[model samples]
Target: MSTRWYPIYQRGGPQLRVFLPNFWLKLVRPTHEQPPNVVQFACSMEMTKYDIQNYLEKIYNIKVIDVRTRIALGETRRVPVKGYIVKDDDTKYAYVTLPRDEKFVFPNLFPENKEAKKDEEATLEQAKQSLSDFMDKNKERPNMPGWFSI
Candidate 1:
């Protein structure tokens, strides 16, 4: 399987074995509110319900109760500068239901509020320090013109 080859088959052939399963399962943030046991995922378009179930159960070790999938149509828009219309690629969305006792909470990857405040505070502190240092350096030359320097 790693060599990317398939063995020849005879009339009575041995069962084919799959050594590697290269399926990608991305954990996507839910668009809307969902039950605690339900998790959203953006998966390969060719994946089936059985494939998702097996993937989660075997790879992730997450026991899934059920799986539901839907194809989201890509938006079509007309280019503002060009006179042609463009369409986005379609996506497949999967909603996996875990055991009722299980819960999944998506973590906040980008936290803007706290980071922005901390950044603003840092800049304010930096400006204050620079101004204080400037005043200290020119303590004895206060009467000089603003633009004049030694």
Candidate 2:
């Protein structure tokens, strides 16, 4: 019962090849607090709880104790100008539980750099000062275009 198409097998022909399932799983930050052993993932809508469990266990080599799945209804909104309604695609989420002793922590992907922040602030101030100077120079000609100045 596979939908994937492959070349027909024949004697002495190339060995039949196996391909991975066309399932996608995205690791997303949990909107609400969860236990350390529970990890959240947004997966393809067609994926079943067993599929998720097997995917993690066989592909990622993670031992799964339990798997819970839920579907989040997508938001619906009206187009501001056309008066038409639009709906977003629904998302399926999987909550995987590992062994009691295992813990999963989301890593910090973006770390703030104080030095870079200070440099950005300094550049903003300089731009502000130059704009103020330009305004002061054009105080006498309110209607003059900024590009007219040197």
Please report the candidate that would top lDDT against the real structure. 2
Per-residue lDDT of candidate 1, residues 37-150 (tens digit): 999999888788999998888877999999999999999999999889999999998999989888888998977798899999999999999989877777888788655765
User: Per-model C-alpha lDDT, please?
Assistant: 0.86, 0.92
Off by over 4 Å in 1: 1-22, 110-120, 125-150
Q: In model 1, how large is the Cα lDDT of residue 32?
A: 91
Using all chains and alpha carbons, the TM-scores for the candidates as numbered come to 0.67, 0.82
The total number of steric clashes, by the backbone 3 Å criterion, in model 2 comes to 0
**lDDT of candidate 2 vs native?**
0.92
Off by over 4 Å in 2: 8-18
Instruction: Please give the lDDT score at residue 43 for candidate 2.
Output: 98
lDDT of 2 by residue, 86-127 (tens): 999999999999999999999989889999999999999999
